[model samples]
Target: MNFNFLDKLSPEYRNYKIERIKNGASKKLFFKISKGSDSFVCTDFNSDKLEYKNHLVVHRILSNIDISIPTLIEKNDDKLIIVSEDFGNLRYDKILKQQSIKDLLQYATDTLCIINKEINFNPTYTLPQYNIELFKNEIAELPQYYFSYNNIIDRIDSLNDEFFDIWIESFKQLNFNFKHFVHKDFNMNNLIFLPSREGHLKCGVIDYQNSFWGESSWDLFSLLEDSRIFFTDQYNAYFMNYFYSHSNQLISLKEFKLKYHLLNCSRQTRLLGRWVKLANELNQPWYLDFISTTKLRLQSSLAILQNNKLTKFYDKYIL
Candidate 1:
């Protein structure tokens, strides 16, 4: 809350007026700094957090590969503030209400295709793989936050173990090997619509510091099957088929659908728990609004997979 360090960036900004941007569930802070009609975004974060560093590195990587992203204008390492181009308020979630689903999805699908095709790891810096252990840790959020907060389950320790085992076995069935770069949070909320740009460049990606090496279907499902938004089965199938046709990933549609549903099940489960934690611990109760939608999506994924143990687990506890 103390922004005294802004003076280090410019003496003129010492008494400047700014607008706080609602950054969603992230701990980081975003503000729009305006000087007359011109404006820039300032991302304020804890200097000690690893995500702050990752943001800079990933920005360089994505920008180099022609992934549409905000242009970095300045960085003050001491204050942990990054100044970048402001894309205004055209976030995909907001724009979707005004635009056709086909056009919007085409732009988003094309961007995801580019991200999968171009991103790769180098020896100098390594990204974490979306391995089984990582998946377990992510899904742990459900038991720790949601169940405990709601007092829905007794003897959560044992039940939590059973739940994890189900997911572990389910993951094994898919036989996914970490292959493509995953923007772990690839939902519409994190994408911006840049109208002036054409093709895939029209979609500006952000908040991807948590990028990882994961199955190709991970990001695709994250976008199409987003828990926060509801797309009809028709829309989901059309866009997914569009991505498969264009991305040229080696996996067939049959295999991709299997992996997509499995990974999305994990993601939705994590959000179900995480939204509760955000409300309780962070005092951000707005997140609770998404819980019902997230739960519905989780059920949909479970229905598609037809995993008896997983379905039973949900029925006994979560339902």
Candidate 2:
């Protein structure tokens, strides 16, 4: 947790002392630099070069759309930093822990509405437009962390081949038409809650370096189905209804439900793989705690797909 990088800053930047913020899943070291009128956030990026670049692109794009995020401060050869409007230490998740359930859902609904308005639907950056072959190719390249975890390999082998085949084929049949810029990690942990003019909640988005042209529901799923915070069913229903009502061209309820389930499954599977890789390869065992949660999600998705409703579809192609 020692962020010695702040000490390496040039004399001009040295005035910005480092403040350790131990709130995120990733290692975050916030640098509080003294600018005449504003304080900037200097977060470290140990991710690959492409990931760093993507983070900048997302920050710029979202900022241009008037989405409330920290302003990009500067990017040196080694560090990426941004000067943002300081919204103190009130993360949405922390607020939920102390606030009413109704307030949490209201904020969630409003946040999604803002995102839907800000993002333009563009297919090129969307995940659904990624063809099945490409999807398989990308997933196939994913390391053994996904398939070989504790008893996960056994589970995969035990699962009926017919079910697995259908799972792959069903992925191809899914409709991917709706596309928009998604804050890939739009969970509560990354959102800051500030008091609005009316004394209600105003949200500021963060950690969007992973933003991409993807499903409109990606962010929603990330927020509602967050592993760290549990949302009530009533709140979830209210939020979903609010989103569908506001979206001018929303998907059918059936399609929406399908996509929601499928995407959740896909995300959890990827997360499981990532956790295992982090533990075995990166030597980060902190990720192991998420494996069971991810496994349950995967199992739930599989059960949903196995329903009698989709049996014919499964038999014809998957079996």
In candidate 1, position 206 carries an lDDT of: 84
Q: What is the C-alpha local distance difference test score of candidate 2?
A: 0.61
**Backbone collision count in every prediction?**
0, 3
List model 1 lDDT by residue over 108-203, tens digit each: 788888877777645365577767788888999998888876677678778878888888888888778686788888888888888999987888
Candidate 1 stretches with Cα past 4 Å from truth are: 1-5, 11-16, 149-151, 231-233
Q: Write the per-residue lDDT of candidate 2 for residues 212-289, one digit (tens) a residue.
A: 666677777787777655545456656766777775446797677677768776676567667767677667687777
Model 1 CA lDDT for position 34? 80
Give RMSD to native, each candidate.
Answer: 2.1, 5.0
| Poorly placed runs, candidate 2 (over 4 Å) | 1-4, 7-12, 22-39, 74-80, 122-134, 137-143, 152-164, 196-201, 295-319
The positional error of residue 247 in candidate 1, measured at the CA in angstroms, is 2.0
Distance (Å) between predicted and true CA of 234, model 1? 2.6
